[model samples]
Target: MLDRRKILTIGGVAGAASVMPLARLAHGDSTENGVRNATSHHHHGGKVTTRSVAANAAPPLDPFSVPMPVPQVLRPSYRTSKLDQYVLDIQPANVEIFPGFKTAALTYGGTFVGPTILATEGRAIQIKYRNRLKEDANVHLHGGHNPASSDGHPMDVIPAGGSKVYTYPNRQPGATLWYHDHVHHLEAEHVFRGLHGFYLLKGYDEARLNLPSGEYDVPIMLRYGKFDEDGQILFSPYDDVSTRTTFLVNGRPQPYFKVAARRYRFRLLNASNHGDFKVNLGGREMVQIASDGGLLPAPVSRKEVLITPGERAEVVVDFSDVPVGSSVVLESEWGPVMRFDVDRRGFDTGGPPAVLRPNPTLPKPTVEREIRMQLSDDQQVFWINGKPFDPDRVDVRIKRGTTEVWRIYNDDSDWGIDHNFHLHMVRFRVLDRDGAPPWPGESGLKDTVSVPPGTSVRVQATFGEHLGRFVYHCHMMEHSGPFQMMAQMEIVQ
Candidate 1:
């Protein structure tokens, strides 16, 4: 077994010296600490001696050869009249990620990717989260409609060995949501360490639609990671850069799922820290039934879906015509992600509904906001509207329950890459992208949208009952930090 103390020391050393300098520059602070630390910073808000790890000492772990393991859906320990409660402990463990190779990883509930939380609309959820690791962390229910207190604001951190109860009033419609670490300056490192899980909200409207259920409904989470010679996870401390090489679906690398010759509902989430997947289903047409927020008005067929970090899409694939002994591979631009082996035949009575859900009528905009995403000339820093994330600064303030149009511009042409725009607590509709109507998959409600370089996208939303301070930022975790592309908003009465 690898020495826990030694690994901690090595991680600290590798992060502190190399990563902290950029972070300090971003935050305008001399020192800070969390899970990923540098020589100038500490860990879990404690002082620790730091050293440097030789980058050339270890060989990189092979991305292939590990059979995929399907993630297990988490069952709540108990339920009450008004609350569904769960307990999660964040800690470190060693698992066989590669064949016969024990890779050290940080996990939630003692798994590589945390357990999936199945929730229902109108039911409140109370999660008692305990941090047993050696660093500070907190949980963010991404794409949730809840009070700011439970929004996992970066400033609202849980220190090492600390615990907190996060409440989510599941009042929104059925959607594919997720939870992960959201520490202010260390979100990238914490998430890259495997602190993410799915939170699927089931609603009466969706349940009544008679979509695929039980084993036919699958949740696929895509992520990438890097491993060292000793099979330990390695996180880069560089600015605007990541070291992801392996692709995983629901915590498994190139895993294959056995499916029946019928239609299957796949809830797809792009959970990578900084990568995007332009997924192609081996030339098979995928019917996209929903986007981030919920069901679309009608199902749209598409050949490919470009899912970036922090975005989710609900797609259905009909395999009724495939031979029983056939195999279908899902591929990204790089290579195959996973496979579906037709092992059985079953009657699929349900198909995509002609009409899914009624679109909410958005009131006239009472406020118009413009936000810009820019990268420094050197591409070392990211900024929002010419300003980096300032905890003390409130970028926008508005009256609660009012509709607004936010025009987000991605001005990062220096690197010629796209940036993702995301907001907390409320869902929005894509008014247009670059003056064109929203694409098929983007027509539904959404909390996150992709903004390509040199383009602007306009979105409209009504700020609902939840009031207080919330955030709007890039979904690329590495692009969100103390001095990165993020801003705060206040909803006033």
Candidate 2:
């Protein structure tokens, strides 16, 4: 527990939202969820319970002025023959994000950007998470095949001053999974306060390929934020992101990183609340070696990688031929995000034979289903198929050894809201998007897919292993929180 007077905590709106599709409706924000799925007419505007207003600032920042801070790979507290043990303290810290301002935030393991946790493929692992916050905290290993007991169910919380040890079977293949807070309604607020980290699995197909390792391998988190005059991070949950123009990489604005003139493997995760990234290496081509579920069957060459919120893409960039002291800036639509400085002479030990592994196929579909991601006309309640989240209700039930193809749609796209679909416990193969084939880079196994406004996505998934309660929802926290657009499916024998 933190000493009462030690950590300086910043106060924020208790139950505000992050992205409101109708930016104009933000003026009237409140604590009421409004007759929850009931028909409208409770018209009280933002004047009712509005909080302090801050500036929509684009801080004056120099491109490449600061060197990117690399997160250290956390060493386990101890290890036995079966599994590794780790302790994560969820608490508050004042981190220096901007050049001269220290942003007070909630962190995991004391890192503004949560540090990476490495585990071996197919080996069991135990993580003891301690909640030092005033509220609840739990870790959801995104992209992991964890059992329902350890899957970070929103209500399976480690309350303030409490602790729990979650054990993962690690029975799935090696993939670039992540850990983030998944507390029911406060997900948006908690994650925005910085509770995310990389959890990568090694020793599977990726091991045979001998991909870039050691210093050459990097994990970078990308997101957008809005700050106030004194460099304090601002959170206006009611606003529809019209003011969040400042993009950041690993919590810094346009920082530069020193990389060797050799092949490097960069694992990229989109940790933002609602932003999608169009990653480009300044016109240079890179190969996509992995997606949300890890190493692809074969490398796909691409000029840009499109990744959405809650998705991960791992690419290998070869700078062995570039001249020393030269730099290539990584840019998105908002301009320079980070710069990679190649200032050293190094050998390029090309990785993995042309082919790393074969693409595994899923069993034929034995069941089919559809769910609509929607919102009420008043926009106060979010729901799936006209109903908000009800933890007591089992929306759908599936037999343990069956495959299902889900037709997920963004039904509220009429309001210009973009949503994506995510399933817990198992990774699925995307069949297509809107009856057409998915992008070449998205062909690999994934647990999340973007269902654009007014469109639908088809995916084939199998629930052959774990049996218990799991959830499917719009990974966008705003919709998941205030809108309540999520449902549960139980796996039974």
Candidate 3:
């Protein structure tokens, strides 16, 4: 085993230029227009500076090179009010990713990837989080409908060696939510070092649907990162655009899972710092039962599901007819994600119900706003509506319980690149995309939506009971963090 103490002592290097050229050298892919302007104005004291560089790429690890390791399903060690209480210790440790390669990692509860927290609706949850690393960190329950105190605002951070207790009134319906580090400026680096996990919320109505359960339910957390020759994780402390050469599912590279010939439910979470996935299953149709918000009115069948970072989608796959001993692979544009081996025969009694939930009634709009996404000429700074993030400034003021339409446009000039929009504390409905009705996959409620290059997306939402301050920004970590694409909104009664 690798020495955990030694690896934890090694600090991460700062600056984007230090690791920019390595991606081109390793992948030979010139498509990525890396940070063209290496000099950032935000450097302390306004002095032009750079960090000493090092080799940041390891030999490419082929997918399915090793058998898949199913992540251990975590049952909360404590619970109350039908809500689970977990004590997560965030610290640095070394994990054996490949057979012989021990990679340095920052984990929750000493695991490379944090354990899944299964929650039920109408309950209350309390998480006692302890930050043991050298840097500040905080937890954000993505897609949660909690008060400002428990929402993981960037400014609400716990210093190293400090602890905090977060309370969540689990009032939202069943959805595939996740938890990750959300410290203001260091979110990219903290998440890149492996500070993310799954939070699955169950509802009484959803349980009645009779979807796949027990052994058939699986949580697939997708992540991407690069490693050094010595197996240490390499990341650009100042750049969010650094390329990742390795892809993983539940912390393993190219793993395969053994499945019975029956219907299975897969809860997918895109937890990468960057990169989006266009997922398909060997040309097999997948029934999408829920998106970021929760269950749709009915299951939507489609050939592909496009999932961006910080997004979640719950899908069901029927393997009843697949021959035993046959293998099927789940793939994305990058390459094969993971393989599924049908090794056992079993009876499949569960199928997608015709109706999953009632469609929400959108109220008439009381206000409308437009937000334009752009990049600075030097491409070092990202802007939302021609302004950067200012914690002291509130860009928009909204009335509680009123409906509003937010028009988000991704400037076409930034071609070949797409941006995603995410709003905290509320689930929304996509009114239209590029003036057309939302695609089948986007018809349901969502907390995040893809704003493709040159296109505009209109979303409507009726602010719920909670009223305070929240944020809306691009989901691209690089853009939202160092580049400043985030903005604040105030909710008034």
Give the candidate number with the greatest TM-score.
2
lDDT tens per residue, model 1, 350-444: 68779998788889998898999876544456788888888899999989989999999988543344578999999999999889998779988
Structural similarity to truth (TM-score) of each candidate: 0.85, 0.88, 0.86
lDDT of 3 by residue, 377-490 (tens): 545566788888898999999988899999999873322346789999999999899889997778788998888667899999988878788888887776687668899988
List candidate 2 segments past 4 Å from native. Answer: 1-55
Scored by CA lDDT, what does every candidate get?
A: 0.75, 0.75, 0.74
lDDT comparing candidate 2 with the true structure:
0.75
Residue 437 displacement (Å), model 3: 1.6
RMSD in order of candidates: 10.0, 8.8, 8.2
- Tell me which residue pairs clash in candidate 3: 64-254, 68-255, 68-256
Rank by TM-score, highest first. Answer: 2, 3, 1
Candidate 2 vs 3: which has more TM-score: 2
Residue 440 lDDT, candidate 1, scale 0-100: 70
